[model samples]
Target: MVRLNCVLLIDDDEPTNYLNEKLIREAGCADTVVTKESGEEGLEYLVSCAEGNIALPDLIFLDINMPAMNGWEFLEEYRKLDESIQSQVLLIMLSTSLNPDDHKRAEEMQEVAGFIHKPFTTITLEEILEDYFKSNGN
Candidate 1:
């Protein structure tokens, strides 16, 4: 398996982050897994990484319903980031929202690689890994 350097989970729900982190660890698909409670924190992390303060994540699993800054708001700011940083990271919108509008919006966003429902599973992790890593000859 081609392990990713880092995986980031951005969600206001603590339990969701905990469970997802555990699942990602068990899957062994990434070397590092980071959990942030808000879209703002996630964006700050990305900025810090871009400034060489930390390592950039290979993938970001972002929740759509955060309090201060929602996933959509984060994407707006993310678009302004340097292209070098943007090119190396992939974003996946993770949400429990069953709204078709949410899915459609995510699909329309060029930066979003995919949209996944909540409760991250090993099988889903494997599928993402295969699609982004294995198929890419990583």
Candidate 2:
């Protein structure tokens, strides 16, 4: 069996983070699950890891709206990172918003791997893992 990758979850909702972290862990989709309450903190963590040549997470689950910084703002900063380090991470936007514009914008972003609705379940985690493996040619 392939070893699961590390996951970085960026969401402001405490319950959502707790539940998603539980589901992701139970689904065996990640070896380590790191969560940040805001996009700014998430970006700071990534930037620090990049500077130290540390292993970056394989995926990032970002929420659209947060107190510190929104997902759009995170992406804007993420784009400024060195291409080598930037290319190592895959971003997935997770939001409760049912807005078509949000989905469209996420699709347009090259760094975004996919979009998932809020309150992720085991089934969704399984699908995400499958997709991730397939994309990585595993």
Candidate 3:
């Protein structure tokens, strides 16, 4: 498997973040895995990277439900960022929501690489990597 430079996980739940981070590490998915408790904090990290002239994470796993800024709200704000800053990143939705509407909404967004159900498994991560990164000759 190709190891990514970094990955970001944005979720309000502490356990979710911990588990997801552990899963990614065990799977050897990336060199760095960053966990943020809220969408606002995730955005701040991204902005800081841009300001400091640093590379952004290769993938961002965003949760749908958050306290202040929801995933959708964060996405809207993300769109306002420079294209260069977002060019190499794949933004995927990671949620426990069983609502089909959420899935559909994710599909409608061009920036969304995929929507993953919560409690992420290694198999799901493998598929995402294969489908998005490998297939595209990354």
* lDDT agreement with native, every candidate: 0.91, 0.84, 0.91
lDDT, candidate 2, 24-105, per-residue tens: 8876657899999998889888988888877888888999988857889989998888898767877889999899999999
Model 2, TM vs. native:
0.91
**Model 2 residue 45 lDDT?**
87
Better of 2 and 3 by TM-score: 3
Model 3 CA lDDT for position 92: 96
Ranking by lDDT: 3, 1, 2
- Per-model clash counts, in order, read 0, 0, 0
Q: Rank the candidates by TM-score, best first.
A: 1, 3, 2
lDDT of 3 at 103: 96
TM-score (all chains, Cα) for each model = 0.95, 0.91, 0.95
Off by over 4 Å in 2: 135-138
